[model samples]
Target: MRYDLDTRNRALTLLRDGVSNAEVSRRLGIPSGTVAWWLHRDRARNGGLPGAHRSTCHTCHGDPLDRTAYGYLLGLYLGDGHIFQSGKHRVPNLTIACCEDWPGLIDAAEDAVRRVFPHNSPCRVRRVGCTYVKVYSKHLDCHFPQHGPGKKHTRHIQLAPWQREIVDEHPWELIRGLVHSDGCRITNWTTRRGKRYEYPRYFFTNVSDDIRRIYTDALDRVGIAWKETRRGSTPYNISVARRESVQVMDVHVGPKF
Candidate 1:
């Protein structure tokens, strides 16, 4: 029953903000006893209530942004993430839906969010077939400007200069995140002249033209070649089937679990 640092910090913050223990528990979906225990422990350590006195603590704030972290988050956001504001709250919620089939990607997404916002606690909720990483933070909007009213392709999607710099510096990492969330690496077998041969390739499918373009642009920065194709009339596909390109992608992205 050991909660992580982010969870403990979030519970404390909610209590400090005058939220009842039950409310905090409900919001975070943790046991009420755990919330009460954490608050009691904090009060015992401090001479007064948990939030009664403020002190200088660096750990009480968010972590500084890094290229790899930002790039990964951006790629995930572009792929399976969405930003929405609840009817009752003004602050926006950033939710990334990860398939339960790939627990590693879900863990990676959770870890990336924790690294970027060390002080804020991201909650994980289980659905029928997928898990969602949800965070309520205004700072999320600053990082992902792609948030809008309509779908990604219907709206404008552009990268800020700083974001561009990060993508330029760490294209491989960005590509890894993008492919991990929306693309897959698989072995394709074909029979030619009664002989069967297998080759490894990568494919990324998305409905957002802009997002696909950003993905391809990142690949281009890394000198990896990709081709664009369409499945029917809606979803666009980007395939990297060349031996050299596949090798490059394998080195960076590997296989998602």
Candidate 2:
């Protein structure tokens, strides 16, 4: 005897409202065994009880997040992270690509994900040149409303007011995450006064103009001066080259160890 969706929902509602399985079955004229089975199935899908999964999602739990960690994760997401929906259940997994050469950064990325997401363990997948740190939860969309179809560059990425507040409060963390994902520190040398000199600079390159703006906005918040440039005809790159600015970057968003 297959029950309609409405019947299942009604039975669930009755059970959630403190009606015993047998009593719900009697009221709805459903078999006691069938009603019990339906409740069990719901529990399995919903992490053992109604709203149990909410405890893992800060937005759903209505609790304050570890916003500093979340802000850094946001930068990583806007830089090299992606979200893919899992199954028909609509839980989305967040994956951030980290270069294989930087083991410390890989560890930091995983640690940050754990700090922001309660009880959810992030996994790492190694690829040709990079490793991906991934964690799955039902409420990723609530955290990252910027997610949508198509490439990120094709979509408009703006932070919500709450997220902007987090970025503003912890601008360096965001900048560090962004630079770790899509930026690097390099040394440019030239012969000056018959001597070789090295100019160490930091550059962040991303294809999305909106993401570029977000990165630069964070830089501005931290009093780091930057210049935007195009290498050839493609790629928007932000450079921190001035002595004062480079010192700031070195202190906060230093080279990946």
For each candidate, give its TM-score against the true structure: 0.75, 0.80
Query: What lDDT tens digits, residue by residue, belong to model 2 across residues 1-257?
Result: 89899999999998888899989988899999999899899888878865455536666778668988998888889989999975674567999999889999899899899998877778999999999999988778888889999989998988889889899899998999999989999998889889999999999999998999999999888888899999787758999999889997998888987
Q: Residue 233 of model 2: what lDDT? A: 78
Model 2 ranges with Cα > 4 A deviation: 1-52, 86-90, 233-235
What shift in Å separates residue 161 of candidate 1 from its native position after superposition?
Answer: 0.6
Candidate lDDT values, in order: 0.84, 0.88
TM-score of 1: 0.75
How far out, in Å, is residue 10 in model 1? 33
Find the 10 residues in a row with the least total lDDT in model 1: 54-63
Q: What is the C-alpha RMSD of each candidate to the true structure, in Å?
A: 11.7, 4.5
Screening candidate 1 with a backbone cut-off below 3 angstroms (N, C-alpha, C), the clashing residue pairs are none
> What does the lDDT read for residue 250 in candidate 1?
82
What does the lDDT come to for candidate 2?
Answer: 0.88
